[model samples]
Target chain A: MTASTAGPFDTERTRSVRGASWTAFRAMLLRDFTILDKRLPQFVAGTVMQPLMLVFVLTNLFPRIGQAVGGGGGASRFSSLLMAGIVAQTIIFIGIFSVGTEMVRELGVTGEVEDRILAPTPIFVVAAEKIVSGGLQALFGAMVVFPIGAFVPSTPVYLEVRPIVLLTLTPLACVTAAALGLTMGARFSPGTASYLFGVVALPLSFLGAIFYTWPSLDAVPLLQYALLVNPLVYASEGFRAALVAGEPHLSLFVVYPAMIVSAVVFTVLGMRGLRERVLS
Target chain B: MFLVPRLQQTPGWLSRPDISILRPRMHSLPPANISRPGGTVTLASEGESAGNGATPHPGAADVISTTALKKVYPGGMVAVDELSLSVRRGEIFGLLGPNGAGKSTTVGMLTTRVIPTSGSAVVNGIDVVAEPARAKQVIGVVSQANTLDQGLNVWENLYFHGRYFGMSAQASRAATNDLLERFRLADKKTAEVEALSGGMARRLMVARALLHQPAVIFLDEPTVGLDPQSRIALWEVLGELQDEGQTVLVTTHRMEEADEHCDRLAIMDHGRIKAVDTPAGLKARLGGGASVTVRADGEIEKLASQLRRAVFTTEVQVVDGHVRISLPQAEGAMQLVLAAAQAGRFRLTDLAVSCDNLETVFVKLTGKDLRE
Candidate 1:
């Protein structure tokens, strides 16, 4: 409409993708944290309630009523055994609910996923950011185990800290859970995701070695081998090795490699599934 | 796999006098009844060029071009057939069509949302399918649906978008603040995105798209849910964007808006472009004619026969309960029509005349009105 129109574009901004993806990844992760910052209370409540309440009721209440757990040490031994399981399962659940369920919701009718799909980065980078952010949330959820393990059980529950194993297993466990969540988010539609939670959640918690070590399931040998197929079994065994190493648990060899394999496999599956879901 | 060169290969388009000659000749149609009555609608020059005078960025480079693009869903639904289009930088181009005419599909292919089953689309010198990430860097899209991050407040939405474009935190914050001020959204910076009114939300979206200064912006049916006031406000912003040399592509069924705002419009139907030209150029194809329509209380076909011999009637056609008469120009055609009607003993109720416009062009090309 004007003869003296100005080319308003600021093309001087460095046109580059070489440094773009990393910054985008960090910013996307920060976006999740920004939302998480507001929902901190809800997140804390949702994350800690199930694991802590499970620990208190089983270790504190059950002993009071003489319907105790554990082989010999009764309250104390069961409390220590239960601590690692709770930490492991809580980490995995955080990943499932935070990354998996959130993915399902964003990808559903709301189409919130569309907001990030065009981030000037590879779609997989966007997907990987979800896993990392979810892993971070799962890490915070795992911390809830320490305080609950310390104070909630009427009996003294000792969580011996093996610094090396704890630090390594912590990230590995969190990432594996988040990666599995990514896969679930990609797999389930809104209508069936709830049903998936119902069918999958109970089995994962109960058969997951959450209340007992996988070694003890030797009394039920068929069940012990079958539990190997569950990803959470490796996380629990790894945590038990980290927190209750003096007790009977799976070997450090089996725990580390099994968890590593699970992390790698789920990450690959999750990334591919996410790509299929979004690109079509 | 149809690769369209940036400009080297488009000799057919470049050699044409103007964009109007990029034209596909009007689709063939069954002849409508016409009678000259006593004399032809005459005493007027027929070769005058388009008069609305929209100048789409002379000598500007192509910001977007698509050639032989096509998409077929897995279930065998062809959303967009082989379609070719070009948009110039600093021009506001409109894709005008009714629902399911493949406007959105075409936009989707260009925006990197919908994958094409075949053919090529390039945006800002990047092939969209092959280098989508680079293409995405230059193009911003405002989708028809509300895809804002409902979880974040308005300010955070713009802030994070800047960050996603690789801006530093401080820079992102600064850009977000400036955009909020420009769009008159500074007061509502902290408001939840879902809580903003329709106009505010749309403005926020446009701001978010511009935060990184993308080369082109695509708005798919941008005014669909907006009220008249909001619609005008949005167009005002678009006009300003055009003056600043921002290329825009909007898809809509609204004829008047397209005519008023777009530098050029590509009329599309049934998954292909029916015509593409400046609004004035498309309407000019109807000649320097004016059309008059009259509703009557008698056999319509009988009135059509009577009007065929009217002194100034150039063409006559019956449509949707009214008889329409076309004239070289509307001067004195109304009285002649009325006089001819009276002599034939047909009672006329009322009549209206309009200069040939986009709607008439659309109907003439597609055989149906746009509102459908």
Candidate 2:
């Protein structure tokens, strides 16, 4: 047998691993978007349908009854409040429930979460990227709901459009929704997550200023403060301040900074939970 | 738990001299047939020095090596125990075992999904326990469960995996297209993976694993639930991968698959390896021999004892209704075996000797059938 010499194969092989780090991270992000994109229709349905139904059902029901039955001309203003609150509510609900449920199912049925955990980037990046994509979806859902809300009757209190407030609060609200979803999604097992969606999400929606304003509930101090703790409260209130400046609105000072701070807190919690879940 | 630290604490083979420090513990067996030939196959040279120690062919560096690798679930079940193995560059190695065996656990540890209770592995020369990200980057894993995004199309699945490996969008697209073309899946690229047959999904998983062109690939029962034709098609694909100089470690319970596809294999049971060798090397070491099966009336174990003592036979054992014995060759040996069985008061119904197979090797070593 003609046995040849050594090193050629080994040296040439080692030289082949010339790949870079950035290329890997980009690949992971692209993959996440591809998966999210496929669920686009369901996202649009939840975002547009839920808010539109709430606005139309509430707005039309008001005028059929006289001022005495519908709480006077302010019925129109209340519908406007309902419109803004519902838009915020849909974004928060869709982002948290949709993203969280998907995560739970992914962790359950297929162990698809293993794909991200095993990717080249740190596990934290994978968690953040998934939430970021969820936030983007939330933004699109909110945008779609606003135009549809215009068709509702009762001369709804029109939006005034404060650029500074809208620009700051909208993204913050989206991030907060996503991060909240991430924290719960990573922590809960899939079996009990539907219960969370029904009990937790619905309750959070009610307490977080989706159907009413904060000062209107001033008689119940505990409820007002308790609702204040819900991130959706700050989001809806902040949107109200931006979209209807002349109307009864929560002060921009409290709503704007609170929205930003809550987003940061949720992001931190999501990052930590995600890191633990992936690494463990 | 003890095995995990031992694997991780020990340096890699390149730095450590004691390659066999995590040597597999032997289970008690009936005393070896003292009348028959017995020799220890030198799996590795004993006194070889560290680092520059001559490895018969210090040729291609090992793509993956585990040192005292172990995994123990919280419920006190030890799935994998002190597994030490080395897969060289460009070789297709198989972990062959039965149901509930730790083949999947061992694969999980190597792939960095399930954290080991102890030990460590270096995959593609990166310390898996110490630097999992680096190790992950170099290895591609096809798990027993389907991880494809069912919502996305086949091309998207391939593209995403490529992107996750950090390839550019254009690069991923190119790789996805090439893989689709190679797997003959180009026509079905736009279809959802959920709509594909089991075989198609499996082939796509393989294509996905190959997108980044990982240096080491872990295939855990890649063709487990496929139909016969699909199983063979996967076999050809795996062979092609081996031919392309990629190192692959596959775990499977299918004896024929392992026999046909593996360059080397380890037969595992009860969380340990019973035997490891090239398919032919294992059989030849059993001796270039054939196994005789004689189904007879009366107590088969008694016949087995009698056949063992007979001068005509080399080794004998009772397996179900038959007295199985191995001989160097079949021609004259079978007649002698049958004559001995007749003298032993055994009424033989069916007697035949067939060439040795992987199934026979597993049974001979583990005292149980692979399907068990």
Candidate 3:
């Protein structure tokens, strides 16, 4: 009612468009969240399934079969390392694939995305909302994966849980993963989405040092540096440093700064891609 | 495919000029008669002159205007070609064209959906290409296809549309309630859009477009595929909008729709404007007058030539063994044609007389049926 105090349908009602852009942005987020709320079961299933399977097979089944993951009592240490890796992987996969696939459908001939684009905000704002929404979904995936990682393994995996590092670094990792997702989603079409999961996502997760620590990957020095090109590597290392103690992991200096830089780079590229797609 | 018989005659209401002033050449016809031919019915001049009683606000000029606006898709397909026109503040303008005629493309350019490849378009005084976001603030577009979010209910669809235009939640809710009632979707407020009937879904789409109370509304094929009753109901809603001084640009291929509802219309074909005028003005300019169809056998060319010489007949053409005669009055022409048939010793199988309408004008200008 306050927005309409001047009169209904009056063009001069909003003297400033900055406030209008913020309102539109919030509305876009609200719409996505409302749809997510209605489809909670699907969201939960999608977010939970991958991490559960990874933690169960590598951390639970392999250990029960007496396959030494790392060495004696290395199973527990490996389990703790895999916990962080699975969580990071869940966030990255969900963030990228969910948004990318959905964007493809929305931007197709159906033009369902037209409603969002029509908002009195820049096209980049719409793209940012998708990233933010994906980030939140990634964070939710992390939360769901943590419990499964904690209980699914036969070995009792101990975590340091540094409050400062855990709180700050986990969000950074989730955001970096979300930014990577945004970049991929913006660049790929729906028909190529399946290829993205099979070709791009699988390589990123496996090469991200999810199963082994970055320090351990120093054994294969060339592989360690090559894997850094994958944004998921920084996220996986950041999570390991935050959740596990006395483990061979990347330094806090490298993890934090790399995550931030990757987030910024991916966000800029994603926004550029979004503008091109929208205007074209 | 079911066409109402042309023999039913043109309704008197169809030609009752909506505006007070009628052009000198647009003389009112008798209840069932047609306009006298040979007078030049020029296309109404652009801008305010083309409007009925519609007036722009003092500070605001044309509601929508385009100058040489064109759209060229990738691979060299030109969807809209050098379109230039001006629509005043409160007139109901119709873009009449068949499928693939660039009506939708023109609407897309004006609505800021499809970026124009060349030229310029201004909506609500804001250049569409330069300030699309600002232009979007004052216009609402209902696309040809259903773009409603099927996951959301009817009320939610309207509410979100309003919110996108910067309306507060309370204002959006209020507007949603008002629109639902006006669109007769109040009872279906909580129903999923996909669950509604085709007509209800269309009404919801229109209601959603109007929730923000835009200055200019573009509706692309708003009543396509709807039943007759639903189409009429939608027309009444549009008529009411016109009465309340809302500027509307609607695209449809139905000649009767343009004839009955539009104050003025532009006929488009192959990405070009074939003609533009008031429905009756177009009918008068191109329709010639009334027409009589004579189904007869034996020397059709002779019958046609003989009929063309009659005092009332303007032209005659033989089409598929039937004589189609254009004349000022069908009543007198019918007798003359019948007497000619008897003199020629040709047996007349059937005869029908009808006044000129938009379909006739469309066929005359485009050399094809409106639906084609």
Candidate 4:
């Protein structure tokens, strides 16, 4: 039959043809997981292994050298601080490596970005989905770190587990980490991103306030200020502030607000960067 | 030779509400204001150029428009100038140009892939830039790069695309089954895309583009890396799409493809459209009905200049060993061409003349080879 005769079309067909926003969002998430599902093991080892090893080495080896250093009390204190810092490090590593690397691969050699770009959903949403997925990976990393940090060397940094603090901040920290990942992924070309882990990421980790308290770096005053630039400082401080509240070492007041602010700022900047990059 | 599409029978339009016309702010322009240079139409306007209501669909020979389309790179490269062009709905519109001439860029803009620099276009009254989501619903895009998913089987790919377009899984599978049988992909339904040869992959890509039943399908160098057999297969698929009452916009540097397959095309250069027309229209506008080439032993230019003054010759030039000339008609002019060659004291080594195809018209307008 001729096409002219083929239709007794309804006027509502246009409206009926719409894709569900949530369905579209879910489809994107499902597709990404399907594609990367095989790589989950790699993510787990990458996230969990480093934190466990760092906790072991710092908690065990450092206490012995404390006497000669004359800052032995500070060393033990530094070790506890370092445990929180290690958790933050795991989050950063997972965020940067997992989401950032996948994005580079998607936008670059594979041309998979086309699938995401052409979808009915906005590009920022797709980037956010990846960021969210990476956040899940960071959460998994934190779960592993909590048990190890609490149990190692038997002097638990105890008694102040504010369920509210733990619940609220863990998700926030993961999101912040993911947002930072998305920002890096969206902004850098894959060629530039090739060096992300070795160069950009490592330096950010060292200066991220992970290993030491922000106020304690007065010995190297410039270093103290410089560390403030890193997002990890906020994350670790937040985690420590929540997990070990009222501890003699750190204050919760500074950590909570700072982390929240950083997460909000990075999320906005990252999402904007993603939109601009994709639309371009 | 035109391969008449099996599906070429015109489809009846169902009386639907003028959904677009209800908007009080749509851009309106007179029919004549649409520019068709060298026979191809471009909607190159800034502010509301997209008209409201059920105007003639671009394939119907009436209107092709774009609205407020802009594509600005993060690194800040303006690939497409804020440009618009419109074609009378049914006329074959050709977009012609050299590599990086923004032919692909314009195609990208029109297909809703790369956003326009700052303006939008409407293909058959579908707002391409402003309502790209709506626009894409009616457009099929075959990018310059191959977009066929390599992991899926051929039928699976078609089925998935159909589902992606909002068809129910059952309906999509049914349609996919039919298409697979029709495209001869039924036998290859279980075979992975990577296993297919180059020709098969190209065919599959065309199949995937059509699965959604888009109104206007864009082909960006569909035959770029294909062997002759593969290219011919792609042409057949395109011919079929056109036959099915679908408007097709194809971008290619292959003059022959544009000349033969395209109903009309625009010649593009340096991010601006140089000319737009049917292959025949472009040739006629280039000062010759069509071009013919002849090879003579010595003094080719002298023979060329002599042919230039002849009554039958419109324009003539000698390049390499060949004397190229445009004649008023390809049939009768050959005798005149030979006579002129003989009278000029130039011996014809080899001579051939045919209707002026896209090659001559493109070179004449762009001052560059079409293949380049």
Candidate 5:
């Protein structure tokens, strides 16, 4: 049959395993992006809502109500300080929802509803492709949320942008966050997804150092050290190193390696969890 | 040529895969027997090379083959046991069994979803165990659930599947349109998958499975939830597949459906095959060999043992408070029934003569009715 019909993948290069796998991998990515494009409104709504609320309340509404933040850095410097933090928070949240919740629905404990896993590629590529897709969505979330954080304040937000740092640290932050989401998605079944918000997302949102720098938590010494376990803290700190260049955030030296390690760990765990769910 | 599946575990797969994984391994495989238990002229072994790991391939006659295939879940439940099957190209083969008879597990093993606990399955010359991804390139599957991409509309479902199988965008779109038209789903191309009826959704799934022109298509309970009209439509599509020379493996508990559509059938129970033969062959094997079932007022076993010797019956057994007597043929069957009844002291509460059919054959072999 193959001899009679030359498929799109019938060329000499494509007949090779590596070339065929690459072709299928790219096609899977194309499918992800195509769906994302078709549902642009939903993607925008999911990406923009939380950051829009955070920037509005903390920078715009808080000062008008006479609330003080950033230890009297004043509302404007406080805006600048929280800007990178909001970028980090937005990317992380978008990453989780874009990848995690959808996965829970697709690989639900009852049965697999996702047919994408049956793609003619190695099984692991399916999980890897999702992580990559989610990370890309998170990056877009960062772009959408940054302007809201930068310009929404009542006062002129003090700001600086380091192009190289932003470009370099942003991808690491996005993928780490996405990989974390994949781990949670794969670990929990559909029935226990509420615990995702209660146990996982709640801690990630509150203790993620979005409103205050990690150094500011020195007053609560135990809590300060405890938040180190959260991958989001590094994302927040890494963005601070990029957007607010000279702010009091965690060292970039520490942030880079920590995020990389977290991304690697989550990728392994998430892929294993998905495989175990399907292959068993 | 495809790499061994074990190598995919490395991170290098995400980057440039090593050329070493692309090298193909070839072996002169020996043919295998398509056998049945009890050696009753069904499933006779063709070549007696049992454990040589030289199981049959798709090249010679069968387009799909399995040798001693088994799947034991982690919890110690044996789902499929020592299953060997051979399916020729262009034929619709069936696995007919009640629920939990391991029919789905066996299909799962063949399709690359469930890894085998032992044994091997090869599809179109590819060893499913050693290179599942490559094996997937040759096989298509329609799972029991409606696995249409909820994210994509009906057309995009087929289009994306084509793309996933390495079709170019133009090719994917063309094939998608062609399949939608063929399945008579062209009008519903833009509709969301959630909006589709049970039958329309199933036809769309079958369309998607065929878009890439896979060598074998596996459909699990294809007509279970469909209406009669929809079932006819699906069967028409299967008939078209036969014309296209596509090998089909379907599983269903509907005896009549299997009897009418499948070229060969394997009746499975308790994770093992009770029989494998053409529907006509199966019926003929038991043809004219009707059974006389007697529910006696006295001890069933005692009456059963006495009747086994007194009556010129082929076989006799006591089951469910009744003694069943099998006759060699339809002629003189009445005299034997009368004789068996007299030996039981004419205390028959209820007596029945089962006609020869797939269900009867299933009941006679397993001592259990197919419909509970």
Candidate 6:
């Protein structure tokens, strides 16, 4: 039998790795957004309700009922602080909660995630698609929270909004939060995911320096330094520096670098966790 | 080629040479050669001469080849053990085994869903363990469970799957429509997967897998829960795919399905293959005769022993409330057994004679029913 020079198999159907990865990424992102679009009412309600309630009760109802947060001129000052903080908190919670819960469902015994994993792309790209889609939702969550925080409170709120800073810092904050969500989502089981709100989300909000400025916690220096571990703290401080000026807060140099570092760290960890979980 | 040693002693009915024992070492064959008659190429290893005897041609390039592929889960549970097999291009190959037989694990390893603990698996010439993403490009997998996106319609599922393989929007849409029609799901294109019936969902899963036109398609129990009509329909589809030169590797517990659909099959049990051959070849290994089943009220063990000693009987076993005997010729053996029974005063309540097939071979080899 003479050896044949023809190729072992046809290559027409095979795809370039780079092209396939890009296509798979776009398809995954589109799938998530399509689902979100179908569930828009639920999305809006879930994203808007918590932040609105927080602003209404803490900023508006508290002072109206003669229970001012701080002291003289303190209610209005606290309102502005609450406004920026609520936006930051809303973004973080939406990122972590949304991605983590969805991941729990996807990684279950009978999961549709199997289809996604079969795509002709590296597993890390699948993880990244989840994070990017989650981040986009977080950005939307921030937008929804902003208007509610601006008008719902009874106090006349004063804000100094910087367009460039807001645009730059908001995306960074959302990405970091979403990356953290990806990591937690891969790490936790569905049964354990519910505990995330109580154990992680609630504590993050309180210790995130949302109720007061990071520098203003000078009276409690240890708590201030410890709260630095929370990514939400950087988000709150970044928004405070942008929307409320002359307030004691972390400088832009610290906030921006910290947010960038956190985003990178969480993203790396999340991808690794996702790969392990999927391949195991 | 490797030759399995023959049994030292044989009954009169089982005097045929065991040709099925010789397994071809296709992995050691020379690279792709010119297609010979029968679309096969004969390549000899160092220890064997090419023209010494008739060897089945290694037809087409191997689509999937695994050597000593092993997977050990945490806590040291071995899912697949030293599994070495080769699936040729453009053939319907069946992996036959009962539940918990590691068929799923082998599929998982080859499909890149579960990582192997040691050794290697190559799918469509790409090493699955080393480059799973690339391997995935050439293979489509339809898992046993329903994996269709519940949130999306049938068309969207196919479209997204095509896009994942890097197809353009126009191409994806065209492929989706074509596959929907081919799978008889065009009417359900806009219907959510959650609303589809069990058979429709299964068909949709297959349509989704074929969207990218993969070289090899793995179907894990494709008809596990389908009705008889659905199973027949799926069988026709699989036959068409094979005719179109699509290499299909399927895992199924149904002996009838394997016999009807697979070009060749490997019977796997306890993470190991007991035998591999065509359905007819494997059946021939079990004495190549007819089976006589006698259900009597007397001592079944004594009757089986007596039948085993008969000149025409090759083997006898009592199972499921009947004494099954294998004989070279059913006509003569049945008369002789009936005369002997009448002479011995052994009353027979029922008797049946049928040709030996894959199920008989499976029972003879594994000593258990296929369903068990």
TM-score of 5: 0.81
lDDT by residue (tens digit), candidate 5, A82-176: 89889998888876777888788888842433466777777678888888888999898889888898888876776778788789888888888
Per-model TM values vs. the true structure: 0.83, 0.79, 0.81, 0.73, 0.81, 0.83
Candidate 4 regions with alpha-carbon error over 4 angstroms: A1-20, A59-83, A144-160, A213-222, A244-250, B1-63, B67-84, B87-93, B112-119, B146-208, B287-326, B334-352, B369-372
Question: Quick one: how many clashes does candidate 5 have?
Answer: 1
User: Per-residue lDDT of B270-322 in model 5, one digit per residue for the tens?
Assistant: 77887777776666664546777878687888888777777656689878788
Worst 10-residue lDDT window, candidate 2 chain B: B1-10
List native contact recovery per candidate, as a fraction of 1: 0.40, 0.37, 0.34, 0.05, 0.38, 0.51
Alpha-carbon lDDT, every model? 0.78, 0.70, 0.74, 0.62, 0.75, 0.78
Q: Give residue B258's error in model 3 in angstroms.
A: 2.1
- Report residue B110 deviation for candidate 1 (angstroms): 1.5
TM-score (second chain) of model 2: 0.71
Candidate 4, A1-280: lDDT as tens digits: 1111111111123322245334445655555555456466766677777777766666655555443321434444655666667778888877788777766666665564654455444556666777777788788888877777766732344435668877887888898888888778777787798788778788988887676666666789887776777778777776666665343433557667777787788788778877776554
**B171: Cα error in model 1, Å:** 2.6
Q: Write the per-residue lDDT of candidate 4 for residues B270-351, one digit (tens) a residue.
A: 5655555556555655645646788888777777788887644556777876888766665577778778878887888887
- Please give the lDDT score for candidate 2: 0.70
Candidate that scores best on DockQ: 6
TM-score of the A chain in candidate 2: the value is: 0.86
Better of 4 and 5 by TM-score: 5
lDDT of 1 by residue, A1-280 (tens): 1111111122223345556778788889989999999999999999988977898899889888888478776788898889898999999998888898898888875677776887788788888999999999999988866788767888888777788999999999999999999999989899888965687777988999988889888889999999999989988888888887367888889999899999999999999988888775
Model 6, span B127-202: residue lDDT tens: 8898888778878989888988877788899888877777767777877877788889999999988899888988
Sorted on DockQ, highest at the top, how do the candidates line up? 6, 2, 5, 1, 3, 4
DockQ of each: 0.31, 0.33, 0.28, 0.09, 0.32, 0.35
- Model 3 misses residue B79 by how many Å? 2.9
Segments of candidate 3 deviating more than 4 angstroms: A1-15, A71-73, B1-61, B294-309, B312-324, B328-351, B363-372
